[model samples]
Target chain A: MKHSKISNLAFTGLLAAMALVVFVLEAQLPPLTPIPGIKLGLANIFTLFALYFIGPMWALTLLIVRVTLGSVFSGQMSVFLYSMAGGLLSYLIMRLLYIRMKEDRIFVVSVFGAMAHNIGQILTGVLLMQTPALFYYLPVLLISGIITGLFTGLAAQFSIKALKKSPISDSP
Target chain B: MTGRNEHSLSALQWILIFAGLILLLLTVRFFFDLSDGNRERALILLDGKTVRTLDLSEDQTFVLDTGYGTNTIQVTDGCVSVTDADCPDRVCTAHGPLTDNSMPIICLPHHLVIRFEPGHGDVDIIAE
Candidate 1:
């Protein structure tokens, strides 16, 4: 039991690091759309995989660590609040979906997770700016979230399947 | 796998349902937004306060200094846009122009927003 616990912690740390790397790398790319809330959200792929294979607790920890570290690395303290709001909401939605659905339906979990993330960020924006004008972007954000979510979700699903065939799959 | 039997719809079905719902919502919003008519005035707010209001029918260019940074706004042929900005993202500047009230160009770093004031009237409604 102790050995498994140690492996679990190590694996969680690895996933967090991978997620942070992906987050920062994706940030370096030019914005896909001029709209603020839209992006590829590639880092979510790691969180989705960890949530499915590792467990909810580890997945949540990895998400928190990755968002915090990614913000620090990006040198944008203001963005940290937005990331926290979006990341936590996304994690919660994915957790709720995971409990009710089969593992094969991870992509569905990811879609709703992405939508929840966008809603959380927009809410944060409304609060910070003290304006309702942000809601004008909601429809566009919803469409973007669905498209990006599908991409990230499919990527996560294939990655999970590939990892299942590897020897280290037994560790988690 | 036993849990799967309890759910009537598959994942693909759920995705389709959501996609269709969102598309329908978008279509409805687009049509409603179009019926609002062309906005003749644009309001520039800094820190949730009205800093400037421009008549969209006029062709003019001006710079707004919001203490945090500067943004150059241009009004041409019933359209308004941020031609340039010193903010890190330049998202507002890149937003091109606002011919409709569908979306406001926002610069988070400077807490500046350019939005069209709907309805033709001298009474300006400050969005809260």
Candidate 2:
């Protein structure tokens, strides 16, 4: 079945917009932990969606747009550096696994991506703060990464399944 | 398609994988936890550079001007904390005094961090 209805550009734009909205909204919540750089990362769902159903380039584009605009809208410009570091590392991990990932296995990608994201953020913190003590947060951040990644991964997996049956499934 | 199913780990396998990783990380954290001694000296850092070091043995207050903002660091007895900060959230001040060298008190907007300098502290004989 031919699944091309929405143009690729329009669909990518829509996904990018959705990712930005989620990113900014998530920032509003009081931090779940005093230990910085731990969050549910719901915005990653759209990046995963764009990558698998759309294309890698579109996924990258969606991620960049979301991080840039999300920081602006959230009124925390310092977050841009940390988010970019985490987002790029996360994207790299998932994209590397994309070819090997089956429809049922996108969650695995999300899980790994989320873990990488945390590592990237913590590393950035250590470098910026010039404090090696920040390494103490590693275990806490990694544990949060696994649990939250599983949640977001499953969410993206289910969303991908739904999109597979939609008009934009084969946009790539 | 050739590589897809070949690389996918079953749900049970992924669960075990995450479980093992979590266990491994927890163990590392446990070891790190034991390594930290009591807070003996407090150091103020701005933009990753050390600006001042205060001895906790001498209970005193120092107002730091980071150029970005100000953080009033207080050392009372063996405990240390940020009593006040010019940053909007002032979360550093709310962090209260730290009991040990576990985590640093930070002011995000001002790019300030106050933490204990390790090794100068006496060993925790109870843990040993």
Best lDDT among the predictions, by candidate number: 1
For candidate 2, lDDT tens digit of each residue in B1-128? Answer: 34548756678898899999999988977776665654677777787677888788988887888888788888888788888877644567767886544556767677777766655332323323
Poorest lDDT segment (10 consecutive residues) of candidate 1 chain B:
B119-128
Q: How many clashing pairs does model 1 include?
A: 0
**Candidate 2 - chain A - TM:** 0.92
User: Candidate 1 chain A: minimum summed lDDT over ten consecutive residues — where?
Assistant: A1-10
Report per-candidate DockQ.
0.50, 0.42
Model 2 ranges with Cα > 4 A deviation: A1-6, A166-172, B1-3, B57-63, B83-96, B120-128
lDDT of each: 0.80, 0.79
Evaluate candidate 1 and give its CAPRI docking class based on DockQ.
medium
Q: What TM-score, computed on C-alpha atoms, does each candidate reach?
A: 0.90, 0.85
